[model samples]
Target chain A: MIVAEQKPLDEIRDLIADAGKVLVVGCGTCVTVCFAGGEKEAGILATSLRMASKLNGNAQDVTHLTVQRQCEWEYLDPIEEQIRQAEVVVSLGCGVGVQALAEHFPQAWVVPGLNTSFMGLPTEQGVWEERCAACGSCILGLTGGICPIARCAKQLLNGPCGGSQDGVCEVNAETPCAWQLIYDRLKAHDRLDLLMEIQPPKDWSTSRDGGPRRITREDLRLVAEQVE
Target chain B: MSAADQVPLQIVAYCCHYCAYAAADLAGVLRLRYPGEPKIVELPCTGRLDVLEVLHAFEHGADGVMVAGCLEGDCHFQVGNLNARRRVAMVKDLLNQIGLEPERIEMFNMSSAMASQFAAAAEEMTARVRTLGPNPLREESVS
Candidate 1:
């Protein structure tokens, strides 16, 4: 899920200070699952903003709306009229959702209310550790499901870097040595031999290195693009 | 605005049913004293306590908040307490960004057997909040 943390209240307050009408948009995808930017968050943000505005003696009109998935066009279609009416939009979604909203509504000033964090899973309840870097590769099979790309301090593909000590990353004692975790998992499975297989350096081309990328499937070809 | 006059801190306490909430109930049964100021919000599991709920509490009027859950691996739901720990950390970061004292929010992991622990936590959180005073959001209502 696209994990996002809320921006500072002062920053947010500043963003809408001059605006007369503000719309808080929430996404119902990765952010919703993380409880960062979702329907509930949108409502809470709207309430907080309203309260802040009231405190400042600058009462402003605020609206809250949540789409099924802000990253997708169809999901955002329902809120088009409302989106157009607002002078500014504060997206409580991930970076993608904010960008998608920006693209859809070029005339409105779009503001991001969240700082999109790394892609991760709820490792334990509220704790979400980065698990995938989306480096355009999958090596989980060799490392017992742990992605070194995200966990390893250096994203080491071959093995533990010199920074690892006593099975912990030097960067932070709380963080476990990703390579050590891999080694232990491999040893438990009696597949220690797989560690000897040298992994090729990750191909950066497939990742976010070269601007935005696209993946098209034959079955999912766009008919609109074909006509254009 | 006098230093002698402390702000009436608003605190939200999320009590897990099986552990923290049960412990709180036990405190009541024993007549164990704890702070009454912090509004208690009971939940089936701390895992069910969303970050937005915490934010909402702060937005409404909470000066500080804490989530009390079962000890690790002791949750009635097996992992709810653990999830609460992780969620609280993220919320702490969010709170920090929002100019609120991150220390205002915290999480405590304990079992039902720790009724004293629960009371102590409540007292401690209330004291911490007293030090922090009421949230700035409550200023409008105050004056």
Candidate 2:
């Protein structure tokens, strides 16, 4: 899931400094799970902005509403009236949600309330760790279900990268060396020979190097088009 | 007395049902006097405390807010107080960002048997908030 954290209150306040009416829009998907831009967070931020603005001798007309999924147009459509009413809309969503709101409502001024951090999961209570880079490819099968692209400090395909010490990355002592984890898991499964295969250099064309990626699923789209 | 002292600060205390609330009740039974300003909001456990609750208290013109729970390593639910403490810390950072003194909110740990500690926690928070004066946003919220 996409994980994000709220921007500092002061920075958020500055985003709507000129607006008389502000609306905080929350997304009910990935961000909600991470406790960043969920329904409760939207209300909290709206209240904070209200109180902060009042304390600073400004307008206090702030409100909040949450959409089922801010990345989808149908979910956002229901809140168009609310979006239209505000001079500024602060989206407590991931970067995608923020852009979706802006693109969906061309007239509404939208700003991000969260710093879109990464595609990750909560490893434990109140802790989130990055797990995927969406490199437009998948190589977990070759690396004991762990992607070196996301976990390795250097994204080395064939690695333990001399910096790996005692199964921990030298870049951040707290982080487990991805290559070490891969090696250990493979050895346990008696598939250590996979590592000796001398993998080819990763194809950069499938990742960010390929620029913004898109997929044309003709079957799904045709079904939707037919339903329309 | 100075005019600021007469501001009648309003403080909110979120007491856990298993410990702090019972201790507060015991304090009442013992006839131990504490500050009257702190309005208690009892929770099943301090672990149920959310960041928004603290923020709401401040937004509603609470001069100060406190969360009282079982002593560290002695929570009835094992780690409710610990969870509350971390949430309270986050609230402090939020308060700081909002330009309010972080001292306006605090977390206290005590067992249900500690009635005296409960009263003391109230008095401590009262004294601290009184020194800071009423929440600056109080007048703003009112008007």
TM-score of each: 0.67, 0.94
Clashing pairs in 1: A125-B83, A126-B83, A126-B86, A126-B87, A127-B86
- Model 2 residue runs over 4 Å out of place are A223-228, B140-143
Backbone clash total for model 2 is: 0
Residue pairs that clash (backbone atoms under 3 angstroms), model 2: none
Interface Cα root-mean-square deviation for all models = 3.5, 1.1
Q: Which candidate achieves the best TM-score against the true structure?
A: 2
Evaluate residue A48 in candidate 2 and report its C-alpha lDDT on the 0 to 100 scale: 84
- lDDT string for model 2 (A91-202, tens) is 9999999999999999999999999999988889889999999998799989989999999989999868899999999999899999999999999999998898887899
The regions of model 1 sitting more than 4 angstroms off are A224-228, B1-143
Writing each residue's lDDT as its tens digit, candidate 1 over A72-128 gives 888888898999999889999899999999998888789999999988888886788
